[model samples]
Target chain A: MSEGKGGGETVELLLPATPERLALARTTGAAIASRWRFTYDEIADLRLAIDELCLTLIRPAQQEGEPRRLTLAYTLDGSSMVVRGQVDKPNPAAVNGDGQAPQPTSVSDLSERILDALVDEHGSERTDSQLSAWLRKGRSVAAP
Target chain B: MEEVFEIAEYSDDSTPVLSVRGEIDVSTAPELRDRLLGVAQDGYSTVVVDLSEVTFLDSTALGVLVSGLKRFRSAGGDLRLVVTGRNVTKVLEITGLVEVFPIFDSVSEAVST
Candidate 1:
C-alpha cells in the first residue's frame, strides 16, 4: 500500500501478466469498491474497467516472450478511485493473423469508447515501448 | 479462487438458447465465443444468450458477443440477449452494446422475439 498525492489510500498490486490472473484483479477491485461503499453499478464499472486494463496488457507481455508482471495502482479516497497501469506493446508480427503488421488503431478507439462510458474520466498514452492508461470513477451519492 | 463460468445449451420453442452464469472475462470469453458460434453454425436461425445469472462480464466477453452477433446476422440469423443483472447490464451499457443487440427481459421473451 502507498499514499495518494492527497494522502488518500492507494492499493497497488503486481500480478503475472496472464489472462488467468485477470479474475484476481476483478475480485480485488470489487472488494475494494464494496469496502468503500460504492453502489452496485459503480462496483461493476470498476471490475469491467480493471478487466479491460488487464486484457490490454496481457497480450503484449506474452508476445515479448518474457516473464512480465502487471502493476496496478488504485488510489482511493472519499470522492473517487483513480486506476492506472502500463503495458508493453506486443510484437506486431506475433499478433497479426494475416501475416502482416497488426493494426490496432481500432482496438484503441474501442477501448476509449468503453472507458469513457464506464468512468467519470479516462485517457491513455502510447509510446513506442509501452501503453499507459488511467481511469477515474466518482463516488456515487448513494454511497454511505 | 475458483472461476465461476458455465455455459449450458437448451432449446426454447425450437430456438437455441445459451445460458451463461458466472464471470465472463478474458479466461472464459473464448469458451463462450466457441459455444455461441457453434450454436449459430449448427443452422439455427435465431440464438438467444441468457445472461440473467451472469455475475460479471468484461470487454473480452463483449467482443465475443459482438463477433457472434455478426456471424449470426451474416447468416440471416440473429443473436438475442436475456440481460437482467446489474453486472451484465452495466457492461453492456458502457460498451453501448445494449443498442446493438436485441435485448429481452427473460429467455422466454428473447426466444419469442
Candidate 2:
C-alpha cells in the first residue's frame, strides 16, 4: 500500500488475468469504497467500473492464450477514489510478424455508456508493450 | 477464486422463469448466455429472468442479456426482467435497458404481464 498526498491509502493488487478473478477485484474495490464512507450507489459504481476495466484488459490476453497477470492500484483520498489497472505485456512471439503494434482492445458500446455514467473520469492508454485503464469517482456530499 | 453464481429454471404457470443469484461478471456470463440460449432453443416464446437475488452485474452480463433479448424477440417472443437490487437496477437504467426489457418488481408480476 502507498500513501496519497492527502494522507489517504492506496492498495495494490496483482492477480491472474482470468474472468474467475474479476469478482475478487470487485470485492476489494467495494471494501475500500465502503471504508471511505461512499454511498451504496457509489460503491456499486466502483465495483462495476473495476470489473469492466479488468475484463477489458483480460480479454485480449485470453484470446492470445498467454497467462498474463493484471495489476490494480486503488487509491482513496478524502472525497474520491481512483482505480487503475494494467495487464502484463504479451509474449513477444505473439506480436505481429509485420512489426505492427497490436490495436488496443475496444470496449463495447454498452460498457462505454456505463463507464461514462458511473465515473467522473476514465480512459485507457496503450503502448507497444503495455495497456492500462483507470477511473476516478468522487464521493457525493449527500453520502454518509 | 470463482464466485458463487446460480441459475434455476422453473415455471410461473405456463411461463418459464430463470431465477439467478450471485454476481454476474465475465466468468459467469457464459453460463447465463447458455441458459438463455437453451430457453430460446426450447421454443419458449416468452421468458422471465428473475434477478431479485442478484447482487451485482457488469457490462458482460448486460451484453448477454441484450443478446438473449434479441434472440427471444427474433423468435416473436420477449424477455422480461424481475429486478430488485439497487445495483442491478442502476445497471439497467444506465444502459437504457429499462426501456427495452419489460421490468417488474416481482416474478409473479413479470409472469402475469
Candidate 3:
C-alpha cells in the first residue's frame, strides 16, 4: 500500500485500455487492495473483473473504428476497495445488431463473467454506482 | 508503486520448472504467456510452472494459461503448474482451470512425478 498525505486516505491512478495498461490496472488494483485491507479473494475477483471490463471495451473500439479508452480509478473506502471503469465500447451485450456494430463472442462472454462475479460480490446497486462513476469521470477505484 | 515480476526459465528435453514470482495480473500476463510459448516452441515434453511465489491472479492470466497449456498439449507436450496460495488456488478452482491443467503443491514434487 502506498502511503498518502493526511487522513484523506484516497489513492487514484488512470490507465489506458491497451493490454499493457490493463495489466498495470490489475497490478495497481492489487497493490491498492492490499493497502486498503481487501481479503485475498476480494483482491483476486477485482483484478479479474478489471481485465474482463477492459477487453469488452476493446471490442467496441474495434467496431467504431475509433480509439476507445479504458480508464480505471480507485480509492480506499472502508473495508472493500471500489473499482470503477468504463468499457468505452457500447455495452457489447446490448448491441442492436444494426449492421453497424460487431461484438466479439469470447470477449463478451468473458465480460459477462466479470460483471456477474462483481455483481455477486458487491450487489447490483454497487455495480451500478461503480459504472455510474466511470461514466461520470472516466473511472475510479476506491479502497479502505 | 513497487512491481513484482520475474521470468520462469527452463530448457528443452529437461523437465522445465518455472519459478513465478509476484502477482500474475493483466499487465504482466503477456510476459508469462511469452515465456510459456517459448517452452512450447522449443519442443519440450513437460513444463511445470512454479507459482508458489505468486500472490495474485486474474482471468487474463488464466486465459493465457489455458491457451498456453493447449498449445503444448496439442503438440503432445504438457504444461503443469504448482500453486500454493489461498487466493491463487481459489482463482484456479473458481475458473475451473485446475482440472484443465495438472496441478501440484511444490516444484520438486511437480518435477519428480
Candidate 4:
C-alpha cells in the first residue's frame, strides 16, 4: 500500500509501560509525524504531548514487575495527525492518583495543560479495560 | 549506544552546576533526578542546571526539576535553569513554569544570578 508523499498513514505501537521504553514511543511518534510533513516545532510538540500522555499512564505497580503494555495508535490523515494512546487499565479516571484529584492549578495538573497547549485538540476516555488519550495536530504546508 | 543523556558537574563561582546534554525524557530523567536530589541533600545553597545542550525536554523531566526546585526552596536555597532550546522553552512556557523558575539564556548568567 502506497501512503504517497504527504499521504495519510496509521502507525500502531505496543510496548512495555516502563520509563526505559518510553523513549521508543516518543521517537516513533515524532518519526511518523515527520513523515506526515509536520513542521519541526509541530513534531517537537507531538513528541512532548505523547510523552506527557505516556507519563500519565505510568503506575508504581509497573516498578514491581507487573509491567503494563501501552498501545499507541497514530493516524496521519493528510492534513492532520492524531495519536490515540491506550493502556491496560480499565478506567482512565482510575488512573487518577488517589480519589482526590489534583486541582486545575496544581503542579500535577500542569503536565496535562502542557499537553493541551502542544496539540491542536486533545481528549481522553475510559472503557471496561482500557484508558485512552487522543492528541491531534494539523500538518504544515511545508510538509511533502 | 551513546548514552541517551549525560550529566557533567562543575562549580561556577563555587555554586554547583550540572551541565546536561542529550534528551531529557523518561528514560534518563531518574538519573537527573537522583543527581539533583544528591546536590540538594549535600547542602548546596544554590544550583544551576545548564540545559543549553538538551535536544529534548519532556514533562517527566520537568516534574523532576520542579520537585528538585521545591526541595531546594524548602531548604532556603533555590534551583535555577539555563535553557536555550526552543523545545525546552516551549514546554516551560506552556506549563506556566517559565515564570516559576529563574531561566537564563546562558550558564554564566544563571550562575551569576
lDDT of the candidates, in the order given: 0.77, 0.84, 0.61, 0.78
DockQ, structure candidate 3? 0.27
Q: Rank the candidates by lDDT, best first.
A: 2, 4, 1, 3
lDDT for model 4: 0.78
Candidates' TM-scores? 0.84, 0.89, 0.66, 0.86
Cα-based lDDT at residue A139, candidate 4: 76
lDDT of 1 by residue, A19-119 (tens): 88888877788788887778877887788887776666675666566776677888886589888876555454444443222225544445566777788
The DockQ leader among the candidates is 4
lDDT tens digits, residue span B1-113, model 1? 85668999999899999999888877888999989878876888679999998987776677788888888899898999999997777767766778999999999888887
Candidate 2 lDDT, B18-113, residue by residue in tens = 999998888888999999989878889899999999988988888888888888998888999999988899998988988999999999999988
lDDT of 3 by residue, B1-113 (tens): 43568876864346876788986665688899888877777777678888888876766577787787888788887788888988777767655567788888877777777
Candidate closest to the true structure, highest lDDT: 2
DockQ (C-alpha based) per candidate is 0.52, 0.59, 0.27, 0.61
lDDT of 4 by residue, A45-143 (tens): 888888877766654325334657888888876588878777785443444543322222343586678877888887766566766667778876755
Tens-place lDDT digits, model 2, residues A1-144 = 889667879999999988888889889999988988888878888889888878667877777887888999899866889888888786554444553224333236777788899999988766577667888999996435
> In CAPRI terms, where does candidate 2 land?
medium
Instruction: Flag clash pairs in model 4.
Output: none
Off by over 4 Å in 3: A1-14, A23-44, A58-67, A72-83, A87-111, A118-144, B11-13
Worst 10 residues of 3 chain B by lDDT: B8-17
